[model samples]
Target: MDHKQIPTEIDREVRIPFQGFYNTAHDNVFDMALEQINTDDSNDTVEVISMDNVEWTAVRLGYAQKYLAEIDKTLALNARFSRIIGQKDYAIGNDILLARVDCSKLVELHDAINADPARKAAWAYYVKEALTERPGFIPYFSAEVEDWGAFGTWDDAQIDCMLAFRGIELEIDETEIAMELMEYVDEKIWSSVIDPDQVPGHVNNKTETQLST
Candidate 1:
């Protein structure tokens, strides 16, 4: 929410579609922070990259991981309910049932794909290709390649390439968030929660309240 803190130089504006299957969807203009090098400056200017979407997703998944056991139990119950209704050929409450089926199937498919050596190799190759084709985001992927390689027996070179690609993607996402924040800052709407004028009063009140208690 602190817009001023967001670095805006490398961040660029993008148009996001609001809904699916709409010829004219609401346009959400946001900024993404990405790595860029400017040679036009008297000295070379290299900006640090960031990604808001990946950061947000990581935070959300981290929360989900914290409550994984609870999530597993809920998923289990949903799957059971789905099975029961499907066995009875009932359509009255099919939505949840269908959802459960889809979720379970997706999990099974993921596991199967992961376990397949051929599929894993294929995926790694695809990632490598993506990285090689996109050179702008090389530095970021270089940082992440080791982590990606640790997941499987993907070729070191291929994993490195993928990591390069991931870094670029991260930069793109960061630039977007940064740009959006910069706009708000430009409007003078961004400010610290505690104003300087309130600091002395806040400290005095805290001391007085502690003494009274």
Candidate 2:
């Protein structure tokens, strides 16, 4: 059994509560690799122009996300298991199920839309058709904006530390197994991708992993 074990070195993680995390993200304290532009800098400076670029990229990403969510893409993805924690007054056995799908396709589409100057008007037209009435533009845009600044400011160590945020009941870090799989995937496929969203579901009442009933 040990030889066949999954070998996830998960016990080393800190279980920060899930509380205050969203607020932290908003406060510029979740430590995401987001831009820290000084508005004091002239409005038309290159930095501000770059900021505009990031925002526009993020806006298009929102359209892609809206289009994809309607597809329920998880039908072609991976799954993870968990139990409820940091919840108040829960039942004795509160297990939760989660799944995620690779958004590589939409991510590539977003990039292509953002890159081609000729497509700029086309994507703007698409966004007006699909994403304006939706609720995800800001969050979606913020993520892209953060990723842009992250490329310049965030290092591997900082990213590793980012994996250690509060309200973080569980940590899923890379292991030998994940690395091998990722290497295989990269070798087999060359594509850009989007981050997955957690799809929570109720399971057969398996709460053994919970810290308490």
RMSD in Å for all candidates: 22.7, 24.7
The TM-score of predicted model 2 comes to: 0.18
The model with the greatest lDDT is 1
TM-score of each: 0.20, 0.18
- In Å, residue 121's CA in model 2 sits off its true spot by 12
The candidate that wins on TM-score is 1
Worst 10 residues of 1 by lDDT: 204-213
Backbone steric clashes in candidate 1, count: 12
Count of clashes, each model: 12, 2
